[model samples]
Target: MKSLGVIVEYNPFHNGHKFHLEQSKITTGADVVIAVMSGQFLQRGEPALVSKWTRTKMALLNGIDIVVELPYAFATQKAEIFASGSISILSSLHCDTVCFGSEQGNIHDFERTLAIMDSKKEEYDLRVQSYSQEGYSFPKASSMAFTEITKNDRVLDLTQPNNILGYHYVKSIGEQNSPMKAFTIERTSAGYHDPDFNTTTIASATSIRRALFNHGGQIENVQQYVPEGTYQSLAHYQRQAGGFHRWEDYFPFLKYRILCSTPSELAEIYEVEEGLEHRLQQTMKESHSFDEFMTRLKTKRYTWTRLQRMCTHLLTNTKKEMMQRITSTKKSEYIRLLGMSKKGQSYLKQVKKDTDIPLLSKVTAMESNMLNMDIRATCTYAMKFPEPARSEWMGLEYSKPPIRYNEETNTFI
Candidate 1:
């Protein structure tokens, strides 16, 4: 069975995501759709709006046949590392193609851009380093370098969020020498970072999240932008977990973590570089909330996303050495199954014989540095919840089986 792979957060699995899944299937002409989703923390350094299990159910209820957890090591990193891990998983699964929604929408442009970068690799690296030394954020430096090197409008635009990710996806595919073909569909209606509801049905996830958080966690506020399953999942998660996950929910704990840790200790955390430890320790004392802390911490050298990711690392006590050891290898050590439909089960059966990586359904007795990081991240994310819910959710890493979705009954078994 041919499979098409997608890298997703599905933070609430809105209407635009459903459209992407549909178009990916049609474009790839694959028999099954596999989504590699972030676990507790997303790429942008924020906690997921809901748990991975809840998001897995949302994917299964939508058109996705299989949902696999993107390990924390890769899920929280920058674009290049994120794309590398995602493409590696898809390649390991023997997916025929990987599809992404992008502003450019054309695959050739990405190919052209990659060729240009390859040709000007040394110069590009030099410029990026120079700009970084001058206090520009890495993404900005890279964008500026690309513009200077390429100077052609025909190549993919690295400034657009989706296009930047898409470019890295294509680059990873080439670097890994994977068999999977790459495809992109034009994102409809909403921009990736647009924080306002500009469309009736196809609003960005950012906008939907903003609405939900602003409107007292009311699912009805963003109901028009997401599917019925997503709406139900959000409502159910809110009721059961007491509230949707957000940075603000854990700000107090983060503040405590920073204040108690010594500068040297904070410096050991991943992404905490060049005296940022002292800044974090000093600013966290005066800031009462996550928003306030971020406002105080923001600088031209560090993007808000970068600082948030750094804070996430600090909150989880993820040391730089630990991340380096985990990410030393090019591919993930295992494929963690989160949920699957009947078709997905059949596909798994077919692929398991030749699969190179271990396909894990449960965490019991599993011992690996990468998997341990995922479990640790789960624990950190669960701590913000109250009472029984906190312990119950954290224990899920050990006890919860891969959710089996019954397509016929439209329910998880």
Candidate 2:
């Protein structure tokens, strides 16, 4: 059976997500849709509003055939590494094609941009470096360089988050020279960073998350944009001791990590550049809230997402040496099945024999340095999940079974 793979964070599964799943199936005519989802931390460098278990269940209920984790290392990185890890997993699954949401739906145009980047590799690199030297953010500098080299307005789309990811998806596939085809579904919803819940149909995950965590918007207000199952799952989490999580929920711990950390120790953390350590140290003393810390650190040169990711590495006690070892040693070599449908299970059964890397449906069954980070991240996230539910979520990686679809009941069991 032909399978289509999708890369997702599903920060909280909403209508936009369900729409993407359905459209990917229709667009690819594949028998099943396999989703590579993030666990506790998202690419935006924040904790997921809901637990991965809850999000996995949400995906299964909404039509994602199977959900495997994207592992914390890749899940929290910049887009290139993030896309590279995801594409490697999908390729391992022998997916025929990978579909992702894009700002510009046309695949050919995206490929053209990729071609320019490839052909002008050195020049592009140099220009990016030059612009970075001029105080522009890396992403902005890269975009400016690419636009100058390609001389194509559409090349500018790479600056947009979704389109940039789609571009990297195609680029990573090409770098691996894998057989998987790439496709995109144009995003026709709210802007990715829009923090409003006014949209009734397809709202951004940012907006939905803000509505759930910060804004007074309750489940009822969010219901108009998410599926019924998503609403129930979120409400259930809310009723639990922790409620829906936000980055601020764990701010005290992060602040403690910051204040207690030595400059040498901060420098040892992954992605802590020359001045960033000192800057973060100063901010820890000056800032009162998580938002304020982020605001103080966020410059044109360093995006909030980048700083948050650096903080995550610090909070998890992920060291520079350890990260180098983990990344160099593992190229997203394992796939942890989060949940799956009957069709998904069948596909896995058929393809498991042919897969090159490890497929882990059970965490305790294997020992991997790469997966160790995921477990650590889960433990850290569990600490913020209210009370008793925290321990359950803490051990959830090992205790819970991957969601199995009951075909007759048309529900997850």
Candidate 3:
């Protein structure tokens, strides 16, 4: 079977995501589409609006044939590391192609930028360091440095989130020297950062999320922007109770972690670097709410997203030593199956025969150091949900069955 791999968070699967999936299949002429998705926390360094299981079910119901969980180690990282981990997984799965959404969908431009960055690594690093010393966020500095190097405006596109991710995807493909071909679908809706709900079917994940988070979790607000199935599923999930999470829900726990830990201790957490621990310690002392802390923590040199991710690692007790070990291993990690359609399961069987890395459909079948943090993160996330839901899944990762598409029943079970 011809397979195309797409990396997604699908925070809540919406119509725009549906369009991307459909267009990816059409563009690649693939019989199956596999997805590597963030587990519980997203790359943006925040908890997902819904649980990973809910998101995985939505993915399978819509168009994705199979969904694999991107480990928490990779999920909550910067673009390059995130892309590297994701692309590595797809490569290991032997996907022939990968597709991603981008604001500017010029393949030549992506290649040129990637080539320049790859060839002039030291120069680029030095330039980035110079601007970073001047207190600009690494993303901002990196974009500025690319502009200076290329003397072109298309490099400006890298500042947009999707295009940046697309760039990293290309870079990772190059780094791997993998056979997977990469393609990009132009994003036509509200931009990634756009938070206001537009009337069109094409709305940003940010817009959908903001509407849900701020407007009392009313599915009606985003119904037009999501597919009928997604809209209905969300309504069903909401009615059933225990869905939708806000950052504040976990702030008390985060606050306690920050208060109890020393700068040295916070420094031991992965991603807390270069005296950022000092600033974190000082900020936690005065901050009132999660929002207040985020605002105070945000600076030109350290984006709020980066700081938030660091704090997430702290709250989860993800250690620098553990991350260092994972990083140094220099191999694609296991493919943890989140869910699969019937056809997906069949395709996975073929993949299993050709692969040596663990294809983890059964969490209880094995234990690895890599899984410990993810399990901890999930348990922490579960604690924030309401009663029955929380109690039922407090440690269900080890017991819960992988979601399988019931072909006879015409539904996921």
Candidate 4:
């Protein structure tokens, strides 16, 4: 069976996500879909409003075959590392094609950008450095350098979220010389960070989350977009408790972690470099909240989001050695199955024997050290919630419910 791969954070699956999945299948003509998704944390350096397991179930309920965890270290990282780890997993799974959403759906443009980046690395690097020296954030510096080099306003626009990630996806695949075909689906109307959702078209996940947090999960605005199972799960959580989860509640713990760790220790964490540890150390003493510390330390070279992610990596005890080791590996050694359909089950059976990586369907498969750390971190994170919710986190498994598929309809239920 042909398999298509997707790299995602399904934070909470929405209508746009559903459309992407459908388009991926139609575009790739694949029988199975595999996703390398974020865990409890996402690339944005914030805890997921809901657990990864919950999101995985939503994926299966929406339209996906298999789901695998990207792990905390890679999930909460910069674009390059995030792309590398996720692409590595897809390559290992022997995916025939990988599809992702892109603001610029033109593959030729992305390839051209990659070619320029490859040939002009030195010039581009120097230009970025010069721009940084003149007081520009890394994103802005790189954007400026790229625009100057390419002389294409369109290429410069690739600095946006979807385009940047899409570029990294293509770049990583090229750098690794992987056989997988890369494709991009044109994004719909919703801007990723847009927070207003009462629209005729689909709403962004950000808007949906905002509505869920403000009014409750039962909002009619989002009900049509999300799967019934997803709504049920979220609404269930809300009715039993006072409200849905929020990353802000965990901010104190994250701050505490930074405050307790010394500069010497912070220096060892992944992405902590060039005396960033010192800045963090000094800022932690005076800053009370995560946002405040990040704002205080944000400078020309470092963006606020970048600094926050670095702090998150430190809080999670992600080390450079781990980063190096994971990258050096040919591919991910294990697949932490999140959710799948009956057709997916048959596909898994066919591929399981030949799969280069181990297929994991249970929590025990998380290896001793990894399991311990993940469980402890999840527990600590859940502590910010009330009594029953805290207990719920403890029992939440890495795997999700298997979705049933109707062969005749060729659709997931």
Candidate 5:
């Protein structure tokens, strides 16, 4: 069976995701779809609206064949590292093609952009550094550098979120020399960061999440934007977890983490740089909430996303050394199986022996540093819950098996 890959968070699988999943299969002509999903923390350095297990079930119910966890070390990083980790899993799984939704839907445009960037690599790097030194955030500086290198209307608009991710997906595929081909489909309806519900069905996850939170965790608010399964899952997760996750939910813990640590200690956490430790310590004292802290902490050198990621690392106690050891290898140490449909199980059984990396179905006895980091992230994420739920959720890291979806019954086994 031909397998296609997608990188996803499924923050709560919604209508837009359903559309992308359906289109990806049709566009790639693949029999099975594999998703590399983020764990407790997402690429943007925010806790997922629901746990990975909840999101995995959502993916399996919504038509994803297999769902694999993107290790925390990579899942919460910037676009390039995130893409590299995602593509690595798909490559190990032997996916024939990977499809992503992007503003620049045409595949050739990404190829052209990659070519231009490659040809002017050194110049682009210098320009990016120069712009960064001039006080621009890395993303903004990179965009400025791209503009300096090419006025070609044919290449990707790097400023767009989905397009930036897509570019890195394609870049990683080439860098890793994977045989998997890349494909893109134009994003429909809402924009990546659209904060309000502007459409009836196809809305960005951001909008759906905003609505959910705005409405006090009411599933009905986002029912129209997500599939029935997703809506049900959201409702179920809220009932089970007591509330949906948001930055506000974890602010107290994060604030405590910030307040207790010395500046030198904070400096060791991943992404804390250039005296950010001192700023985080000082600003956190004056601020009581995540929003207030971020408002005070925002600077020309740091994007909101970048700062959030740094905070996530701080909260999880993820040190730069831990991240550097994992990233320096530039490969995923394991393919963590989160869930799989019957078709997906069949595909995995057929490919497991031939896969280049270990396929981890259980976390117990795992010795890899990367896997240890993932466990720590899970534990930290679980800390947000109250008493029994906290222990129960934390235990899931060691005990929860890969969720098996029985397609014939349309329920998880």
Candidate 6:
């Protein structure tokens, strides 16, 4: 069966995501949709609002036929690593194409951009350096340099969060020169960072998250935009105590990590560039909140998201060594299963014989093994919720079931 690949967070499944999935299937005529998704942590360095199991179930309930965890290291990393990790996993699955949402939506333009970057990398790199030297933030400098090279007005907005990642996706795929075809669907919804929910066709995940947290919007109103199972899941989670709205609940842990960290130790953390370490140290002493600290550190030379991701890496004890290693490495020989259907199962078996990677559908207690260690670390943190809730969350790994596919209808159950 032909499979179309997607890299997702689903942070919570909503209408826009469902549309993306449906369009990918229709456009590619793909028999199966496989997703490499974020786990406990997301790409931007924030904890997922819901557990991966819950999100996996939601993905299955929606249109995805298979879901594989993106792995915590890659899920919470910068664009390059994020794209590389997702791309590697999809390629390993022998997927025929990768479909993603983008602002430009024109695959030709993306291809053109990639060609320009590859051919004129040195000049572009020099221009980016010049802009950074002139006090422009990384994102701004890169965007400016890219626009100067491409002479496209829309390229200026290329630095927008989704567009940036989409660019990296194309770049990474080009570098790998894999057989997977690439396609994009134009994004139809609120802006990536917008926090409003006033839309009909689709709403941004940011807005949906805000509405869910604030309890100000009605889920039924956006019912058509989201998968029914996802809507039901959110409703249930909302009614549960200690809702997932506030990410700052973990602030104390971050503060503790910052407080206990030495300058040398902090220097070794990913994104801890020369003077940035000192600034973070100083901010730790003066700032009272994550938002405030980020505000103080934000400069024209570094985007807010970059700084936030850096801080998150440091707080999570993600060593610079690990980041470097993953970047230099070309492949992941293991597929950490999040969930999958029967058709997915059949596809896996077909590919497994020829795949260069191991397909891991179950976790084992092997702390010494590097691959299993990663899974263990995620499980360890996931099991840390308050009291009885912690036990319930931890037990999901064993109790939460994998999806079974129905071959007759060519759908995942």
- Cα RMSD to the true fold for all candidates: 0.9, 1.7, 1.8, 3.3, 0.9, 3.1
lDDT of 3 by residue, 91-128 (tens): 88999999999988767778877776777889888999
The digit string of per-residue lDDT tens for model 2 on 14-63 reads: 88888888898999999988999999998978988888988888888888
**What would the TM-scores of all predictions be?**
0.99, 0.96, 0.95, 0.87, 0.99, 0.89
Name the runs in model 4 displaced over 4 angstroms. Answer: 152-156, 216-221, 240-242, 274-294, 328-330, 366-377, 386-392, 395-413
TM-score of 6: 0.89
- Candidate 2 lands at a TM-score of 0.96
User: What is the model-wide C-alpha lDDT for candidate 1?
Assistant: 0.91
lDDT of 3: 0.84
Which residues of candidate 2, in runs, are more than 4 Å off?
152-156, 386-388
Q: Residue 289 of model 6: what lDDT?
A: 80
* Residues 1-413, model 5: lDDT tens digits: 99999999998898889999899999989999999999999989899999999999899988999999999989999999999999999999999999999998899999988998898899999999999999999999999999988875467889899999999999999999999999999998999899998888889999989888888887888888888888888889888888888898889989999889888999999999999989998899899789999999999889999999999998889999989988986679999999999999999999999999999999874689899889988898988898988998899999989999998899878
Give a tens-digit lDDT track for model 4, residues 226-245. 76767776666566545655
* lDDT of candidate 4 at residue 274, scale 0 to 100: 85
In candidate 4, the residue pairs with backbone N, CA or C atoms under 3 Å apart (3 or more residues apart, or in different chains) clash, namely none
Clash count list over all predictions: 0, 1, 0, 0, 0, 4
Q: After superposition, how far is residue 41 of candidate 6 from its true place, in Å?
A: 1.2
lDDT of each: 0.91, 0.85, 0.84, 0.75, 0.91, 0.74
Stretches of candidate 3 off by over 4 Å are 152-156, 386-389, 406-409
Q: Write the per-residue lDDT of candidate 1 for residues 189-280, one digit (tens) a residue.
A: 99999999998899998999999889898889898999999998888888888888899988988988999888998999999998999999
Cα RMSD (Å) between model 1 and the true structure?
Answer: 0.9
**lDDT by residue for model 6 over 36-104, one digit each (tens)?**
998777877676777777788788878787888877667767788789888988988899999999887
Q: What is the overall TM-score of model 5 with all chains considered together?
A: 0.99
